[model samples]
Target chain A: MSSALRIAAVAALLSLAAAPAAQAHRAWLLPGSTVLSGAEPWVTVDGAISNTLFYADHQPMRLDGLKAIGPDGTEVPLQNASTGKYRSTFDVKLAQPGTYKIVTATDMTMASYKIGGETKRWRGAAADVATAIPKDATDVQVSRNVRRIETFVTSGAPSTGALKPTGKGLELEPITHPNDLVASEKGRFRLLLDGKPAAGVEVEVVLGGVRYRAKGPELKIMTGGDGVFEVAWPEAGMYWIEAGVRGAPNGSAPAQNAAYIATVEVLPD
Target chain B: MRILKFSGLALAASGAAASPTVGQAADLTVSVEIPKLNVAEYHRPYVALWIEKPDQTAVRTLAVWYDTKLKANEGATWLKDMRTWWRRAGRSLNLPADGVSGPTKAPGRHVVSFSGGQLAGLAPGDYALSVEAAREVGGREVLRVPFSWPPRGAKTATATGSTELGAVSVTVKP
Candidate 1:
């Protein structure tokens, strides 16, 4: 093969090797400490999309969609938020003595349509579809993407006031308080989709520190009929849980794909 | 009608008086030992004692020893250092709890006794007494002693910790 063709062939092989790793990149928000005591204790959190859990070696997770819900259910602003090359770091001053929910949710609409004899793609919010896609376009296919990444931090006592679900996308209704997890004890939670129980969904649970182990100790669990699932932690550390579901297209509405990811800390008994 | 009402009131009063002494009272005594270390800077460890069911759910908190006298209750700040108890029960408890919270103790064996009246609502079952201690600039340790409720007989269970805590024991008497 010619030099240019040989280079193209090698690039194709390299891209093939990198495809799976890119698809496996997990996004997480890791707090320095999940449970805290004291008056107005501050917690630092790092956001990243990386292959190794909790370790920021890949692309930084953007903070534009990040929000912190205070103990009072009010939106609290993140302090000293900065986005570095590999991660995003922010601080939260827990003035209230209850649990706070930090979340980053992104919603987008992906569309592919044929213009004359050519195909074009557009990605944006659902509201922009009318203007972004011409009326003459044919064979238009649209899909909605919703991703929610979250973690909890408690200052003093943990409370559930901030844990109420938004009735949109995939969310966790924690029967077992997230910050109160202990090793060897069962942690119970319910999954919800669009304000209703999301039953029979597959949930993935993996403890952090995957870099030290030869194999990723990932646990697969299915939500029961009532959408509740129990996880008996093998040991104490940070754990990442993810669940996703796809909705069938209905009438004129686009097919929806939603995913919920949470990072929880489990203490040794 | 007056006579019937009077008799009914009298019967209810007698029934209330008879309940406390109905059965054998269950008394529990826990002894916690805070080991003295040779470190240059030593601070009395904050300790917490609580009862948990076989499923590890905290039934009741027996005692919490910490620096309760700090101005503005600032000493409660480090209460999370006793992490296990804090997550299990302490976080939910209001500090300065009557009869349950006290000041930190010096290095030595401290024994606390709970009468049947204090343990009144605890159901009859197998339970464990968990003792956790954390010190400033020092380590933390937890020791659990298992025992059954409404003692079958005079029973004593003990556990030892290498650092931050010494020998801990729980005693139950019928």
Candidate 2:
């Protein structure tokens, strides 16, 4: 084969490998300490997208979509925010004496279509869909992806003011305060999709230190009829939870797929 | 305090008379020991004591020892340090709950007594007493002692801590 053709073939294979499947690469935000006790303590958080939980061996999760919701349900700025090759680091000053929600959300649409016998793909925000594809494009397929990653850090007593569901995409309505989890007790949480109970959804609970263990300790739980699920922590450590669902396509709109991920720390009793 | 105690007894006597099924009233005494450590700084630990069913549902919060005197109720901010109690019962309670909330204590054995009125309405079943302590610039420890409610006889259960706490004992008198 010609060297140029060989190079083109290799590039094609690399692009195929780069296309990640749903749940292939996991994104997480791990806080240095979920529970704090000072008058005004600062909590550092690391963000990454890796195959292993909490391990920043892969790509960095961009901080552009990151936000910290203070105890008052208002937006708080992240300090010392920096993105390196493998991870993103930021600090949150706990000026308020309550729990804060650190979150990152991405909503986008991807479309593939054939124009004049050539297949092409375009990805951008949902509003750009009209301009992304040509008017004469045939066999056009489009889909929407919405992902949210979040964690909680408490400066003093954990308050629920910042934990109210936004009635947006998938979210966790914590029945048990996230920062107050202990190994000896069970933690309860509710799943909401667009502000409604997301029942009968499968939740993936994985312990964070999977790189050290021979087999990953992952627990599969299904949300009850009330969109509630209970997790009886096996030990004290960090845990990653994820749940996703896909909606059926409406008349002209693409199907919307939503995913939610959270990193929670559980203390030993 | 004496008048309050006398009125409490009067109320209990009247309530018991109104309901024969209300068995003999039982009193619970919890002694929590906050150990002293040789360190550069020593801050009194925030402690919480509560009763839980076998399923770990908090039935009643006996006491919450914290910095109740901070300006503008700032001390209540650190109450999450006692994490288990905060999730189970502390978050719902208003601070300085009459007899349930108080200031932090020094390093020593502090005894807290709860009358039948305090532990009233607990169905006869297996229960556990949990004492959790957290210290600033230090560590956290939680100790639990299992016991049954509506004591068939006088019972005593104890737990020991290593870092943030010392010996903790719960006794019930029939």
Candidate 3:
């Protein structure tokens, strides 16, 4: 091996020994309650990006442009992005006795890397191989990850139709209402791009900390000509559905990619 | 949680109770083939099979085979390896569930059937029949056969997994 190759091998060995334990990044949506008693009921939501079932040891995430969709079809602004020692908290008030949705989203993030003398910025599929950059050339690598979180709270008769796609970004519209999800019940959804079925989309569902691949119960599948897909909802809690689309490359560096995420809660019937 | 977990079975049982002699032929049949592979550690796999809606909701669980014979159901500890299935519906199910649960099968083809009571109240719609397998010290794989509900005449779909499992097929009466 050449001197550069030897150095790179040594660095790989060192990283294997010194790197932190591998953990998947997850956005948790913790709502105060799913069902309310009477009159106006408000839910306190604690949202954070972290590892494990619940804990905030990771970096705080900036949930850009937060809003709450009330049952009455009015969009209310959520308040407080309080960054805690381990997590962040936000609050939303449900003025009516129906299901309310609190959502926050971030844009697609791309990072530029300076390796050796060449500067390279890759997005979409190219980012998957960015690690191939040799240590000698690994001067600096920057990464920005896009993420979104959503939670549903209900006050009285659980409502639906509040989650329609807004004709923007990669989104999933559940034919099966979020509030009505239960075990042994059908959970259906359609992938939409600009209000229609989103064509040629890739999806990743994280369950029990394990992300679904091309097969399995939550089989990684692409929408057919109809832009509809289904997953076998095995167990229930908060399931993070990650969807991404890669548009045409803007000059061969990498295709401009966009991602959509929603954490839907399924209650025990 | 327990009530909702067993309601599927309960619904089936009630349907059977209502008409003892109806004896509806199983409308759907799931065929899963396990390939014998040359691996260092070759323990049988714990597999989970179910049907889901277009939204990917698990509408019904046909069967789950894991380390059920262990004294304390210790084999279940590894069920999480089935990843996608565990998160979608496995974790909530009580072990040793009467008709919907069983023990893991050796390398071969296995069939799990669903009848009238078992499939009580399933509405006609687009659905996917999914199967996943995870083994001890072995790899994991998942297969999905997307098919419509209440088969118009006879409908079937099949998919082959790359590892752990072989060909998986779903068949429903037309």
Candidate 4:
């Protein structure tokens, strides 16, 4: 073959080889182990970059513009803790008690990509009546008032059995408030038939193997009731989802129910 | 003051319940299609399928079809765009699923099936069957279909979404 013909053949081969590499950039956030956990809760967004064939001129694949938010709309900062990894921690010290959420976004290849996960919020209160220890004793004690103490338990479901009486034999009473109520993770859900407020509805919100149950209150409220139903979740992690509905067999609507679901992240205390 | 008290309550409340049923392996079929890339003529995409609750929680990982023939690394980078699946299930598992094929699917259409009993144990409720496709260099698209399993019935349902997939039909074969 002539020299000119050989040059032409080499050019063709080079173009063919680069064809696949020239295609559009495929970028997605890989948060390793998806399940974020800890006693003092936080999240580690770690994952590999797959098929990320970048242009020769551009930098190698890296997580750009990533952020996480807690359930109360607090921003969790992603710290550059190591190579090819990003992390964010939220302390409930300043975060409001409710379902927290984390939104992660990345700007790469001239486009911005985003996704998020939520964690259940369980903010318990220590309002029980306290009893003083011996004058020199360092132990502080409280009388367990059931109603007052119940307010701190996530979901306040009887199954939890986490509620306890104080040394003064004070029982913790359960109160109705939208403090930490996560919806049921079950697929199909229904509310009570009594047209009154949706109380006694069993809601089981499960993420991974963890389950949090929130039961509706017996208090009656209008269809568009403004009352809040809360349940305290056990763990502080990423993304908590609750699913359920309201209706009444005791009212005009029979077999009628509505479904409500929400996602949020629970920050650590 | 309120913060201090609430923290105490939060600690007591973290009781988690039992595991949701890992659906029994019921005979089922899943089809994934990829149109020939307008250019590179690259190999098929590596697709992943899993189940997510209507509430958007990862339930289980059903299948991940990728380019096993080449020993190519199925990078975890692009797994996030498989949004519905990632948040619901994928993020929970360790990498390189053993005993499963990982070769990318060729552009076109592919039909895959699983044995019966896979659908069992999925609590009777609403669920979204999700499938995601990732090309080595091309863009990624995920198609999800909504479905429900009644208390005692074996049936089939079909739904469609805009993405690399054409049509997805899920049948519960008892």
Candidate 5:
């Protein structure tokens, strides 16, 4: 009987250690920074995970008691369900008219892939933690959401000082809706330079830590003789625009020599 | 057994003495710039730079743009976008970089340089230097520049890139 009790005590200790620790669930609370209208909104769930203990895409994990706190400090309950992986979706009703905060949790592991045949490890806890969602959300900030960017391009022979280091160059504009974003719509930008029409100049629009590249023609625009052009917004979010010719001497490679402008902010209407 | 152990130690010491110290410790000035847009302004880009060998093997991580200013953990998610630098150097890092942090650079001309003494332990050989930039909402471009170091003396090479960088110049001095 004494031996039996000893065995039971050891087993209990083992179970305690194996059980999830207090902060092990620190990464779970999902944060939804973006929500689009006219479609189901998916809240993004992400956090730093330790590959040493947990595994990726661990299912059977669920987040309960989700609520959004408005900028005025009002608690708004959100309806949600885990779709799979590191994502969750909710109906549009949960998104209030103002900025909000989201709190939830998930159990996932961090894993590292071999780069050039080396195995690296990411160290962190396995349990989910609660994270707040910011009110001012962008497409990139939302999990699995995409934004649209539109531009108008025009092309014409450079006049005396046009296209020179100092000249009246181009104008890129961004349009967004209060609605959410779509993935395929990301990475689209526009270009317009000189007084004559400069159509089809290669332009790139980058945002939310992702890059989307497309030719000016695909962006759709009609150029006037005055070098004024336009394209539709392919993605929505805060964005930075760059427009230039592919073949230039600024860098050894033509792609390397292309010049870039400045960053721009696009807010949804 | 003792005799064999002694022989092994002797060989190791001799090999160590004969090895040339070529990984010179060097300092590099780094900068990043993302083009501007009017449609939807993009946030600053998150850029990473590192040194690698000719075969595309990683030697060291020079910089990374990971921080809280952008969003909660957005910097960590985008680390993979800087593919060249990530594969060559970043994937091997055990922790966030110690010195480099923050969002992308504004649109402007920027410059970075390195020296020979900074590469204190490298071997003298033909080396290819590569710099890669990736913008959050912008495209990615990798610029490769080749340089060779003779055991002694300071050698320099300059390489430039397009897109996200107004200009990326590298100066190496012994």
Candidate 6:
């Protein structure tokens, strides 16, 4: 199939998967901090598949395209990478603070071949334009569910200038400084659709890795009438705030589910 | 055995790291309840206890109970199941992390304290005491209780799990 045709096919498959009945799960890469101060400061990160965010114990699945970005904007590998029952765990030392981001991608693309009698999931960033449908292939389907998680870290006080959305999907453009968060502190965050405050979206903050609902401490509230949501910090440390909206299948635009996941850090004082 | 020395995470404190003298005298005690489930095969759950600042930076590790008797730290393979702590501070540490790593506890309430190096030089600020438990062929649960450094009066919080653990609690006394 041609590149343009493959792209069209993928869009069609994505729209089919966007039905309200389909499960819209999210994948996230959460870091302990976006900003690291003082001597020998380090941050640990957890990655998993859960639409609720920060709650790794819920449907914890491995994340694809996991990598750390150094202050210089380069891909850095994690040491002692391991997967447990809940999520994949790894740690990175913020030797130079700045804006270190932890990023991960989830494969939401679906490719179904009729002849195989088995549905094969395809990644949006993988080889889509090259492979041809195998012989006896009666039908082929493709869709997109790519999610991105971005966390930041700085040496001193965090800077809002550098912490902007990567324009990939839905994002939480935090009006509140993420690094200087305190336990039980009330914070304000704006849900951004295309660099604007998205309205009436649902947002949640999970205190720890929880597998069951109402098991651990978590706060779930819909974004206020506007796109901004007021979060009462449930007790700092590492927390994931996730919120998103469903972009209806528009003309030529597939039904896209944009999920915004941001790992925020709150300080002790 | 690394012999309970203050290094890496222990010695490395944040800018908030203050002299223990000025930080109110406080004590932290964490208790984990290992549930005894009547299953076909049962193995003790690996548990990790540690404290983190609002930034989720590990301040101190109270305990990491695993199969310490294995030859050449063989039990370390499954340590990652306790995802939160292993990612926050466990990997940087070698087993027999003296004062930290120990053998798994049977179904009972096990307690450990934050004192000596663990208590001293603790910066006064809001922090969370996180306790995580994961058992093989079972479920995983993580409990986090928010408290202040140099604890004032007495602060306590508890989290109960269905499979791997029962009621996990944390208490800090003035």
Which candidate number has the best lDDT? 1
Best candidate per TM-score, number? 1
Lowest-sum lDDT 10-residue window in model 2 chain B: B15-24
RMSD of each: 6.2, 6.2, 16.6, 26.3, 28.8, 13.5
lDDT of each: 0.87, 0.85, 0.66, 0.39, 0.40, 0.66
lDDT against true structure, model 2: 0.85
Q: What tens-digit string does per-residue lDDT give for candidate 3 at B1-174?
A: 344335546655543322212323337888999999898878999899988887777887778888788765556556656766765676555556667778889999988667655765667688898898888888788788998766777777899988888999888874
Worst 10 residues of 1 chain B by lDDT: B15-24
- Name the runs in model 2 displaced over 4 angstroms: A1-22, A224-226, A247-251, B1-82, B85-141, B144-174
The alpha-carbon root-mean-square deviation between model 1 and the true structure, to one decimal in Å, is: 6.2
For each model in turn, which proportion of the native inter-chain contacts is also found? 0.66, 0.28, 0.00, 0.00, 0.00, 0.00
Docking class of 4: incorrect
Predicted candidate 6 versus true structure: per-residue lDDT over A1-269, tens digit per residue: 99999989998877676352234455566765554333335667777766564667555545446776765666666777778887888887755535566666453543455665754444443345226446566545444454556666654334454455666666766766665566656788877766666788888776645555466576787777567788777565666666656655454334566666676766433
Complex DockQ, candidate 1: 0.52
List where candidate 3 sits over 4 angstroms from the true fold: A1-3, A6-23, A79-81, A108-147, A200-202, A208-221, A252-254, B1-174
Candidate 5 on A174-214: residue-level lDDT in tens?
22211222333332323334323346665544443232333
True-structure Cα RMSD, model 5: 28.8
**Per-residue C-alpha lDDT of model 4 across residues A21-108, encoded as one tens digit per residue:** 2222222222322222111223333322223211122322333433344443445455553433322222222122222232322211
- Point out the worst 10-residue segment of candidate 5 chain A by lDDT: A153-162
What's the true lDDT of residue A74 in model 1?
A: 96
* Predicted model with the maximum DockQ: 1
Sorted by lDDT (best first), the order is 1, 2, 3, 6, 5, 4
* Higher-ranked by TM-score: 1 or 6: 1
